[model samples]
Target: MRSQENGPIKIDGIDKMILNAFMENANIPVSQLAKDLGISNTAVHQRIKKLETSGVIDSTKVIVNPTVLGYSTMSFVGVFMNKPSSYKLVLNSLEEIPEVIEAHFTTGNYGIFLKILCRDNLHLMNVLNQKIQQIEGVTRTETIISLEQPIVRQIKL
Candidate 1:
């Protein structure tokens, strides 16, 4: 099952061209897509459908401006668990916290990595003290707040 998704994606020349076009403009019109790919509109539509079904393409969405919405800080928290069996409970608890934008289980000094976003230092402190640190298995947390976000990419294609 893993190999099926990992294996070569069956893309023809037209599909690659279509993906290139979509990379530039996700909301491109079907007629324009066909024109850009030099294929029939129906072919472009079918290829897009295939890409979506194969998970080569995900849904298009508007990028939210974090500064506009008052989310000024982005922080990474490295959480260390007290015990070996604590990982599951810690992960479940982390999943319930909305501020945890991204989390990953790692094989290193830290058991979990959490990407957190908040409006200010006060908000982050509260979240760490009142929410994250209170989780059952959490022993220690190390936080690094972002000074600047130089590059952010959704994906090229």
Candidate 2:
């Protein structure tokens, strides 16, 4: 079926429950999910397949601990760009960098803001000087280095 332009996909109660279960653990097996939801494994598998085909469920991935990898410095940089009009063109450009974790457009003095994860001062400096500043319209930036983050998990259904 053809989907409408710019509207959220309608999710029924059953689908919502299935999605919530999967969100908690993307690598969950169909049998376990079926057992937990009190449904047949076949039903769970079909629903997951449907969601994937419809573009609602993207690829599953493993979430890793950055601290365990010895990447301790976490910084949020709010960059003010001179060229404020090119958001879409610039957003993709920012995502190309490996260090940039999140880039958001907000209503503030800054045109673009990014959350960057770096190994140390040298890494962070390289990201700023070579990577970020190279982007057009990035006039000024204010970086807030996080000493410690209380939480960094997504809150879902």
Candidate 3:
């Protein structure tokens, strides 16, 4: 089931249907899923278990509303490292900042890109100045604040 080349996992039709249903609602009851799919509850449960064990289903978590939680500012930071050898150090430093929600090693102008969530502009500034800039290898950063997110959804199956 694991691929060294990061290839797609082998999934049949039923697995696709099951994945689509779960993606629509992760909290859906297994019995209801089974009924809707015209399959036994035990069969559905076994399939789900297999999917989880095989790393097909990584995790099921509640998606919290960041706005409701007072995280109003979403910003992306493009990190420029001093040298290639500094990547690991910069990544370790980035992880210590709680505001950093996501980080990716990219292929373009920036060595690393980060998605940060903050309560306000001031919070974002503090994170950039006091936290991110403190990392030795991080020579500079370019940030763009998100005004709105019109579309956000998982990929089609």
Candidate 4:
């Protein structure tokens, strides 16, 4: 429960234990979790349901390995637009491109930032020159290819 209006929700030690366990393995069985936590299966289920209702748990997802599908190159792109009003249209256009895995309306030199995946440098160039640059409002783009990603994890509970 939240202590104040629109404030962060308050959770106990047991709640933290449950969240940490689930964070390690979302597919962990409820029975196993209950046994590890020394609580009943019903208790674990109730806590998870409560966490979901309180908006702490958004949704479970299957993380995919892009390399297995031949998407080896990962690049971050900073996109500049002709005008701020073109944001919505540009966003809608970006949504249609499957290579654009993530997009952000950020506070910096670029009006928008994108994380894209492709097979190689050539594929990245084609995506940038042919698709992204062709957007009506897109004026320019700056791209940086990732050589290695050492850290990728959620926030500490």
Which candidate has the highest lDDT of all? 4
Regions of model 3 farther than 4 Å from truth: 1-7
Tens-place lDDT digits, model 3, residues 40-130: 9999999898889888899999999999999999999999999989999999989989999999999999999999999999999999999
- What residue runs in model 4 are displaced by over 4 Å at the alpha carbon? 3-5
Show pairs that collide, candidate 4: none
Residue pairs that clash (backbone atoms under 3 angstroms), model 3: none
What TM-score would every model get versus the actual structure? 0.87, 0.82, 0.94, 0.95
Encode model 2's per-residue lDDT on 4-108: one tens digit a residue: 365666667777888887788777788888898899988988888888877777777888899799888999999887776867767777989999999889887
Which model is ahead, 1 or 3, in terms of TM-score?
3
Worst 10 residues of 2 by lDDT: 1-10
Model 2 spans with C-alpha error above 4 angstroms: 1-6, 86-93
Stretches of candidate 1 above 4 Å error?
A: 1-6, 154-157
lDDT of 1 by residue, 1-157 (tens): 1224589677767777788777777788999888866779888788888888888777877878888999998999999999979999999999898889999889888999999999999999998999999999898899999999998655543
What is the overall TM-score of model 2 with all chains considered together? 0.82
CA lDDT scores, all candidates in order: 0.86, 0.82, 0.92, 0.93
* Cα lDDT of model 4 by residue, 7-114, tens digit: 998988888988888888899999999999999999999999988888888888898999998999999999999999999999999999999999999998999999
Q: Is candidate 1 or candidate 3 better by lDDT?
A: 3
